[model samples]
Target chain A: MTQETITTDVVIIGAGPVGLFAVFELGLLDLKCHLVDILDKPGGQCAELYPEKPIYDIPGLPVVSGQELTERLMEQAAPFNPEYHYNEMVEELRKNEDGSFHLKTDGGLTFHAKAVVIAAGGGSFQPKKPPIPGIEAYEGKSVFYSVKRMEDFRGKNILISGGGDSALDWTINLEPIANSMQLIHRRDGFRAAPDSVNKMHALVEEQKMKFHLGQITELHGDNGQLTGVSVKGNDGEIFQVECDTLLPFFGLTMKLGPIANWGINLNENLIPVDTEKFVTDAEGIYAIGDINTYPGKLKLILSGFHEAALMAQAAKRYIDPEAKVTFQYTTSSTSLQKKLGVA
Target chain B: MHIVLVDGHGAEHKLEALEGWRVMEIIRDHGYPIVAECGGACACGTCQVEVDPNWAAKLHEPREDELDMLDENYGGEWSRLSCQILMSEELDGLRVRLAPISVKEAA
Candidate 1:
């Protein structure tokens, strides 16, 4: 890994709606931002968990889908040209004597920033692994938690587990190119969209692929080159499913992950911050969104948006101590509009 | 300002508090045993507290979301999510008792 270091005015963690809004807020002040997220995309929970779920609490907008909200936020922050490093988890965060933060990601990327914003909503979303012995050995080779590329599964016998959108979506996506495709779950019920599930059933009826009602029991592979898998049916029959690739989507769980080790004070796994600037006990580090706790803090996207506004103001002062601070609204500030490319 | 917090064990402790901070923040900041699993989102009722009967009438009415959470997870008199209660000068003498289901009990 190269030891080169990248510098930015501010480094915002998590690319959720709040983090995306932080880009806009900080960008308006002429401070560049870089956002890091564990997921491959920008929207955190909203995009991963419930992209199509309708959200009614966002102010002004009477109704909006989770995916739409993420899209709009990304659009609003587009002019800022915020750097997004997706599919990477921040592994280390340390304070330098110079009062700036030195950060490192699991993907071997590094950054130095004058200010840091923790916009991670309820921490990082970790994939739930199935209960199979020695499954770790096959991970990253034949077994995968998420599909990053469709071409990787091309011409391979792929067996996908789980009944969620990820499983069904991948099943539909990889069907055309795979040598053979099979889907397995505990039962016939699926938590995925009905339309997708229907399409999967239609495909199965046409003999394009196979669907099995069973749970993964064992792996039939050596040295990570999966040859096949053992499946135990609900009716107590054990059978082998031939496949070289496995994709399991058991859903996701939230964990504070490495953020708990950053020397920041955590109250029951949530960061504590002051209401004024939403800054944590650690100087130069600000916590916004669901990851932060304060008196009367509302863990809503709208509340995070408000916190991002104040956080940008405080972050500006921290980055430029001698600079004059002026409050300007997007509706009235010509400079802000120009930065947004709308003036 | 100072506010009184009655722990789950019925021990009362007074702590310094800020005027604009949330009651949940004050409790958590002092290392009080409360679990805000969802932070202040009002989605998880882990931070539930029973406002002192007398003070309940003095505080603002719970919001619609707050009410939905209370109705869904907790149904007790004066039960409120401390995160939803903002501290103010009028709330200086606020007295809140920890509900039966705190982070400790839930965990």
Candidate 2:
């Protein structure tokens, strides 16, 4: 309990590229930000979804890797000198009588800011877990939902579950290092990219590992030691496999935490927001990025950037309802002057 | 509900949480005197908690964030977040501990 209260002009919740861009946008508007995130670094889902995957349509670059794009956003946001609070989820958001906001975190820390931006990409940013019974009991024990490092799995028995590109990619990745591997999926079908699947198939042909097409029915272990798993295929075939660790790649995800109950009208899971107005059902709160839903808007990283920019302008208007839109340039003038070298 | 940390790394602190809640939720509900910042998103290392090492194999993959955080952490093998842990019948006598203090940096 340190009595020191940290304060900022705005708070950006997620650290994804769009969220990072929000921090940058707030800074461009001459506002300081406390860019809080759960990752030790920025770059939200991109870090997990596609670190090396190429991304087009990011404006400026013809092609960029996800990790590179995240780095760029972090650099752009660096100018604002935003304070960082990594490894903490915003436990609660409370507004004071005077209109200022109070921020609390899961880590027992409190922060104060003028405005809040819920930039969490695609709901809450945690890996989806397997539905097998007793799985939760061994989260920190032997079962895992993610692949942290390759070395950690060396000489260890590992089982990966998922039908998506992430699972396939991880399977191809850990093949060389892990002591033994089992790639399991509930459905006989796979959602992975053709190339990745092909590669995994090639690796499987090499007789280096194994693959099981079925959903995990149970994880059997004792005293925290995972011994094996039960897989029930669509054809009523039950197979039991032995393993020291289980990594289910079945992509389960969440969105909007407690804010979902704030009475905001969400189209599906995201809050439907007007691209131009950036208004949500809630009067004071505005949404941007993957959390925002609007007609004809395809959910993508590029779309999120657009949402973030529009929402920043709209939020400024909301905060100062009496102000009129001006066509004049605000802070870019200095940058332009610098570009022209006409000091 | 109580989060029993058997690892005994940090000052043993127990929290009163709702039953049927995720282990991370209880720790988080009690102000995360233990760290679960990602909300058990398995994305960061700050929530790292060592389970009763005897039962460590039951834990699953560290996920992207958990793995990333583990790579950047002090002790890799035993570090994990309580949020990723669920409290249920199987985990009745589960023992875990708050990760070391240094890992909380930027967590």
Candidate 3:
């Protein structure tokens, strides 16, 4: 929780493919970058949503998985030694009196940067809450999206929902401490790893925990404290399951959080930026990737890559107005090759 | 081909559908509210829709991967990821309601 301020040449607000590529483009010009992402990993949607899914239109690479692209981008940007601050969302952004920008993350870290790059693909990834009515009332008190501390659930009755890895993993991890543990899902089938699923079944077979085939329909609680949940079974039977704590792992979804509060003009949840330079309405602040919009904007990864290259040049000039930026290709420029450590 | 879409407010809008295009794409292209976060990869279940029970029998059963995604996203008996539903002559005039989760909440 220490309020420490870090100084950097540029601060990128996302660690997605475009943000990672921005490091290479900015690094080529000797501008050090620090990237902050809400997800725990470097790749944004590529890592979270469909890491194993194949992408076809990356150019030159006929086909590649989302994860492989992220790895290659990280490797390509590695020579620059870009600093990554994962699991932190840029919460506050302000322009300094001297024209430099100041940024703060939800994790308490702050940054003072000459330029800011908004490569946030679809804003931040937030846990998807179940559509159960009144579920928000119990959130943070007795309903938790993620487990921060296992000890907090000791001696409590817990009901876990969803059939994903997060749900199964937490059920096994928290079974030992809970007085009673129950798992509910729309179907008996699980998307989690086989090993974890087996372990959960073993716990259920031993009468240590209970597994129910149903989806949560209603939450019953009082004053932010959950008492039980009403579940609709796969057979259309409605039943009540008693639990002091409810954990619904419905996976993650993207939201345009905090970014709307910024002064940047937004067009239907996307930042409006120029085709050239990709600069936003705010000076020294640039937008790229899917989060940005223009007259003929196409939300494509290759488009974001092109935008990154242009943004780097504009950012460098904005940081130092007298600085001369000569356009050179990585294949021909000895200086660029040296920077990429291939010389 | 066309399909009837019931929005979040229960307003029905008939939208033209293209052959071989996903129902999610049709809804999105017609300026309807749908996240389709994964862009038809069938990875995210944010593009969920509630198929009319009469029309549900006309469509093919969901695969294991789709079921897995639906299980994680609180999909019910009539729930199906619209991204997995490809439009065809048989699915013309299909009726489906957008799930509450699929529509973006008013900011």
Candidate 4:
């Protein structure tokens, strides 16, 4: 170990809503925060999954798309000019006897601060692909789990597999450029949002690509070049379809890493926390967002906002002891210290 | 119709499902905040919950994408994403515990 150390008023891990909000609150208190996240970008879960999906219960608006929500969050917290380090995964968290925290990442970077917040949304969400027989043979040749540069897919034969909105939406998005596109589902009916389904209907009628109700059973190719595939449909019939590329948008599962082994009580996979305070048992550490568990914890963007705002205030108190929070989220300054007796 | 006991809002809902609906939609339709990211399309693991240990026998083991989602959720053998299990009346009364996650965590 090289033995490096840093100092700050607050050290926030996982730059999700809670972490971002802490910067705002810290700014109001005239304090500084160092934010670290595993992702290359901010907006946490909103940016990662369903960037185009609409979110309900954000307080003012009945609905906002995930991507748009992320944009707004970044804007609101931007005024604080919070510091951040991206593409870094936190591997360890340690606290000193004087009530300070130390953070280390897999990339050999370390951070030191007075307090830490765990805002990693239900861990990290990434795309998942089905295990088609012989599929591994096509890796990097013609199969992909996520969309990498938007320009890469132009003018190619593509087949998208999934019933959820993303799989369907991609079908609609890629229709114009793809030499031809096809949507395949295990079921005849789709469960995607109505708007996306409608778009697909228009594309299907226009003969843009097509839809097949079934699963991809096998991948066929010679010399690492994809030729076609075998499908099992709703009618229990197997058929061959010719295509050059295969895309499976089956979606990803939530993952929490070693934190699950830190001796925290978990109800299934979610870490248990105080319903009112959102504090984990580890003392001086807290978890907010989708990874936390409590009674009636609605998994909504607005809910995360509430949890983040409140937790930020509490973490301030944990560190400052003398800091005052008005409206709970007001972090402008210690200007209210004598007025409040929290210390 | 198949029956599945879902863990929701800290309480398990003994949900009854139609033949075609995914388990994620079943919990959501019953008014639970399952927050099926990717809308239960399995693109995200926000709908994760632990399978009822005894009922695991009846349910098909989650495939790679589903297992990967579990791994992302700090998955253990007992953990599963509800979206991966479709409803079948045969699963009626199966027991499960909802994973401790907020909609934000799943996102």
Candidate 5:
């Protein structure tokens, strides 16, 4: 396959609020940007983890949910028409000899950019696996952590373990297609929304599927394929739940991922960035948002916004070494207003 | 001052802390495994930690906002948002365990 290469002025690694804001800031300076995210959509952790959760500290918007904040940020950057490549992660980053950066993602897409921005909020969101004995053997086979494709388990015996929204939502989504479905959890208490809980209960009452109060103790299968699982019930009884496919929604955990392999300096698992321009140890590369750390750094969206503004300035200078750059406000600068389509 | 942070794997790490710095900053600066999703704004409770019972008395009471956020996190008696706890000379040698993160899985 001929790998497609996209050449751009700025390459942002995350599509979260800060990354989106970076596009606007860079866009105002007439710089083009292409964003890549591991997630299937923008908003990073905000959209993936807690879309409905309200965030009370986004400065101007006294109260905004994570999803709303993401939408508004996208709208704010729409005039720039930043290119986004979702459902992919940047696996490798190398600096070209000519001072440009080369990046490749897990999906085989490559980008060459004059400047690179790391706005990854809390790194990559990885699925938390259930701490079951010998469970690792079944991973990627019968035991799956996430439902990337709904049709993978079609007509298979599916067992979902968790009392959270993912478990309940998948139970509802996969019940009809699954040959036999069993929803298992430690107890009747659920952390999912009330409506989902109600729907799950209604399905259970109708005998469309079964619900068990237990925890997975062991996986029963051969060579990565599962035939059943040993479940320890709340009443201290161990029983076998037969299923060919197991989906455990243990929630998500943040991993620094491939960025850790990059040669940039790291403080803890975060990138150490200079506060002046939010630039990392590497030239023409900047780290912002929760992924970057500095003295007295606050991992707030507003702080990332401030960092994006400064980062754009530094990036502009790096992209055009001999050009004179001036600071201007959108409210008064006709040129800035023209870029935003407001003049 | 220095403090000890216990990660999910039961490993202990000693880290430097500055006076007036939020506990979240110290742990985060060192790349320990606590997620302060809202930074230090006291909005998100992703930075919850269990203070050592012995040192719990030395900590200040959680404000109403912090308490409310903790309630949202289903906090217990020992639960406190690391963002709300400021480091001071008095807080030296503090040992804290990360609160197990329990997030509702979204579809």
Candidate 6:
């Protein structure tokens, strides 16, 4: 299958608050932006980690939930018509000989852009791997963090772990197809939706599946194939549950995944950028938000907004050296106001 | 006062504690490996700690939000989000072992 390469003026690597605001800043300068994020939707950490948690530090808004802040930012950037590519992580970044940047995502989407913005806050939100010894050996084979296709597990003995919605939902969805299904959690109580929990319990009552209260301690298998798992029950009893597949949903955590291999200078996992332009050593490439570091840098949403504004000016100059960039206020500049759709 | 922190490797360090500061702050300030990713918001369970059973009852009960976050992190009975525990005069020398999940692996 042939994939078309998208060409744009600017490509923002993250769709978090900083990246969203970058769209507005670049938009004011008449620069079109295409944002790529690893999440299925926008609002990186805010939407993923703590959507309901209140953030008082955002300027002007004394109190706003994470999800609300993300929505407002998205709305503010809507006038720019910023295209967002979600659920795709940019795995490769290369500087083209022609001075433009070439980028490719894990999902096979490619882009050529005049400027690149790295606003990934704490890197990509990846599935948190449980601290199970020797579990890495069976990662892609018998042990899986996410189920891409439910049909693959059909007729296989499956053991699902975790008490969250993923665990309970998958336990119900896959029970009908699996040869045997067992749900193991650290506790009897679940954090999943009430209806999902009820459905899971009903399946258990009907003997459609088994529910074990314990944590997986060992994976018993070889050559990346699993035959069973040893569980340490809450009552201190150790038992083995025979299974051909293991799915663990332990929630998500931020990791500086592919970014570390992008050949940029990193200071303890954070990109170091100039305070003025928020630009890394790489020409036409910028890093902002919590993923960047500079003298007196504060990892706050407000600070990232300031970075995005300055970065846009630098990016505009880089994209077109002869273009004159005049500083103007949104409240007074009609051109800026027109770009914001309020003129 | 001081709080004792047991690292993942079983090494212990006694660190100074200040009033009104979360236990996560104390551990992080002392240069331990705790991530405390959300900056003491009690949202990310990366600052989890296994409180010594003897002193677990002395700390204030885990609130609903804290418990919910812990549940996502596979927390147990003695497990608590260090960000939720505030340093207090009543609990002078609290002891908490850093949960394995909370340790920031060397990058």
Best by DockQ: 3
Better of 1 and 2 by TM-score: 1
In candidate 4 chain A, what residue range of length 10 has the lowest lDDT sum? A334-343
Q: What proportion of the true contacts does each candidate reproduce?
A: 0.00, 0.00, 0.74, 0.12, 0.03, 0.35
RMSD for each of the candidates: 10.6, 16.5, 1.0, 9.9, 6.1, 1.4
lDDT per residue for candidate 2 within A113-168, as digits (tens), equals: 76778787765666655446778788877877776677878877888877677788
Chain B of model 6: TM-score? 0.97
Alpha-carbon runs more than 4 Å astray in model 1: A1-4, A133-142, A147-158, A172-181, A189-209, A217-232, A235-245, B1-107
Candidate 2 lDDT: 0.68
Worst 10 residues of 3 chain B by lDDT: B98-107
How do all models score by TM-score?
0.68, 0.54, 0.98, 0.56, 0.79, 0.97
Query: Sort by lDDT, best first: what order?
Result: 3, 6, 1, 5, 4, 2
**lDDT (tens digit, per residue) of candidate 6 on B1-80:** 98999999999899999998899999988888788888888778999999999999998888877876786787877999
lDDT (10s digit) by residue, model 1, range A1-343: 6978989999999999999999999999999999999988988878875576678899999989889999999999999999999988999999999899999999999999999999989788777666678889999999999877888888999999877678889999999999999998765666678899999999999999999987788998999989999988878889999999998876665678999889999886789999888999988999999999998877799999999999999999988999998988899989888999999
Task: Score residue A218 of candidate 6 by CA lDDT.
Answer: 89
Q: Which residue pairs collide in model 3, if any?
A: none
> TM-score: which is higher, 4 or 5?
5
Give the per-residue Cα lDDT of candidate 1 at A5.
Answer: 90
Query: Could you give candidate 3's per-residue lDDT for residues A1-343 as a string of tens digits?
Result: 5876999999999999999999999999999999999999988889998899899999999999999999999999999999999999999999989999999999899999999999999889999888888888888999999998999999999999988899999999999999999998887788999999999999988999999988888988899999898888878989999999999998999999999988888888989899889999999999999999999888899999999999999999999999989999998999999999999
lDDT of 1: 0.86
Ranking of models by TM-score = 3, 6, 5, 1, 4, 2
Off by over 4 Å in 6: none
| Reference-based lDDT, each prediction | 0.86, 0.68, 0.92, 0.70, 0.85, 0.91
What digit string (tens of lDDT, one per residue) describes model 5 on residues B1-107? 99999877788889989999998889887866566765666755778888889999999877865764553453556789998899999999999888776221121
Native-to-model Cα distance after best TM-score fit, residue A296 in candidate 4, in Å: 3.4
Per-candidate iRMS values, in order, are 9.1, 13.7, 1.4, 9.2, 8.9, 1.7
Consecutive 10-residue window with the lowest summed lDDT within model 3 chain A = A129-138
